[model samples]
Target: MRNFKAFGHVIIALFIISLSAWCHGQVELDKAPMEKAEKDALFSTIQGFVGNWWNGSDLYPDPCGWTPIEGVSCDLFDGFWYVTVLNIGPIYENSLSCAKNLEFRPHLFELKHLKTLSLFKCFRSQRRHQVTIPNANWENLAGSLRSLEFRSNTGLIGKIPSSFGVLKKLQSLVLLENGLTGEIPPEIGNLKKLNRLVIAENYLSGHIPDIFTALGDLLILDLSRNSLSGSLPLTLGCLTSLLKLDVSNNHLEGNLLKEFAYLKNLTLLDLGNNRFSGGLTLSIQEMHSLEEMVLSNNAIGGDIRILKWENLHNLVSLDLSNMGLNGEIPESIIQLKRLRFLRLSDNNLTGNLSPKLSTLPSLNALYVSGNNLAGELKFSMEFYGKMGTRFGAWNNPNLCCPLGAIATSNVPFGVKPCQQQIKLVESNTNGSDVNKTFYSIASLCHAPNHFWWTFPFIMILFLNSYIIGL
Candidate 1:
């Protein structure tokens, strides 16, 4: 019942977000006249990409006043309307789908007041036709553009423009899941005010430029799922204000650096599925603010007890699975009261399944499978009831689950239940039955014929004894 309520709340939140976006992109009005030159530039740019069939001016008495382009948003400045945000591609139901012969026009960069421009799935057909983004002249909008994004355009092949570095005012730049090849241009570091730079799921290869630390205000820097190789720049520790840093699923190789402790505000750090080797540094554990830390699938063999995990009081999700981590599971790990997910599977971890694990109130998913863990699990029935199959404890031959009084509704998978032991009673080895021997001796005294003879013998013996005495 609690889970259902939580799920329903999530659904409501998502609906609210969708409605907000729809409201922001739909019907917006400012009864001011738009500049003729900027309007022409906007019309030509829209016609070139969305294919001319949808007449812009004919849609309403004033497009900016009544019904505007589905994705384009405008703002009033000096009593004149100007395009501030334009989002192309099939994002909304009425959003203009890319024309079969879509093309970029020079007028796109002429919107002097434009602050945002995003293209989503405009070049989706990878095999049919491909297009490269403009390699130059991005400087025209450098003064006003604050955000730029290109998302999920598979046929968009080419190198990221080096000219983009001139956009000093740009606060966010996202290039997600495209076929853009080549290395990330170093000029991207020149954006001093950059807050977020997400360029993942591409064919990009090369070492991440050391210029990353230049963006002092960088909040999120994700470069996951690419072909990037070579050692990560040590200077990355200089981004002290960085919050989320994900370089997973790349070929980066290096030792975990102690300089990582400089990131006093980092919340999420994922370096999984890389070629990182050597010891897992304790410096990262010093980042007490880290909520999620994923370092799985690297050859970074290390003892799990190197750092006191209790220091990371804000830890929520911790994954150290599939690495060759050794030593016993540290008891101090149970100190993280807010820990919800803990995965230590496929490692060389040893020792007993501590009963204190059940004491963590927020822990829901705990996977410690494929380790050298031993002894009977001592968690309460309520713990097993809530966790169920989420408590993964498989492939440890020496480990067993408690039974008898405990129930199995939420038994941890892939481990055997403990067997009940019984003591055997000893049998008499002298080969005589006690009951039969006692009954045989008693019958001699009780039988009728035997009693008569016994009385005569007794009387004769008494007379003989009396005569001798007299």
Candidate 2:
């Protein structure tokens, strides 16, 4: 009986030990391989922000596991789950907290596996507290980072770090609509692998660096609305792969470079509101892929006919408003079948408005106001009504003609009533008397409705007398 009891106790002990070992193994499998030190650093940095949802608790004990944090993604690296992308913003509800004085924590650089880091309107503050981007340790992650973006942070002030050139793997870098000042670092040319670099709507000044021609793979380069000045470098033409290039609303001066024709892939080129002078060059006609060309509010001069506009078949929008352009508008412009917006306002252009201009199937907005244009508006009533205020042909003194079918109020402003001309014969009359009689005939024709029938009756009477005399 003693031996039986002892054997039963031994069996129970062995079973309990086996069960304990199996449970331990399962627990190990459930836990993440991420180092506890790195996890604590990430959570601590997030805690400093007042509006963040990350609170150190068992509720999210494994950040890389089932309870993953918002705007944070992880991937397995060397048998450990590491944060690979950190998109800190209000991307998801109850995700990130917004706080003033939100300085980037050094602990963020500890995520050695981070490939992309974006902060959208995250550093904004009601108090206008300025935050400078940290330039000290960016080189630490140069090897891992592939993209970095900081958009619409009004309080972000400071020059872009030249150290960013060391990030060889970076493909896209966008720092749009910030308060950043100073010249774009020439070192940015070193980013050979970069595809898109947009730093528009900032206080950046100085001439565009000639070194930019080195970025052969760049597709979109927008440095608009800055204080940049100087002539564009001829080297810009080397960027054959460029699709969109906007350098508008700056102080840039000089003649448009002919080398721009080399950008075969360019779709949009905006150099408006600058000091560019000289005539529209043939270089622009060579851009077969161009869709929108904006040279408005510049000093560009020359007749519209100087351009071989027929070559630009893909053009959709052409804005040459307020340029010192003169001479008659080229009738060939009607060849642009895809044209939708044509703005030639505030120019010195002359000649009668083309009837075909109003008939273009795709044209919706036509602004030729403030020009020296004359003659009658022969557009269809339906087309004129459809254009409405978009047809701005005001401020032209000699432009005449009443709207047909469409109300006069619907017609473009400053249009005068069409004049009537009547030829009079004064046999044996001197020059002065003939002039007086001509003026009298003109005044008679100016009279209300009676003038139309009265003039015809007078003409028939003169014809009958001449026939009888003959």
Q: How many backbone clashes does candidate 2 have?
A: 2
Per-residue C-alpha lDDT of model 2 across residues 87-123, encoded as one tens digit per residue: 7767688667557756677887777778988887876
What TM-score does prediction 2 earn?
A: 0.81
Summarize candidate 1's per-residue lDDT along 1-470 as a digit string, tens digits.
99999999999999999999877655443456788898889989988888888667555645566778888888888777889989999889988888867888999989888899999999887887788999777888999999999999999999998999999999999999999999999999999999999999999999999896688899999999999999888788888899999999999998988889888899999999999988878898779899999999999998989988998999999999998999998899899999999999999999998989888989999999999999888887788788877889899888877653223346676776665453322223464332311111212111334544575686577567545444
Point out where model 1 deviates above 4 Å.
1-31, 403-407, 419-421, 431-470
**Cα lDDT over the full model 1:** 0.85
lDDT of 2 at 142: 84
CA error at residue 411 for candidate 2, angstroms:
1.7
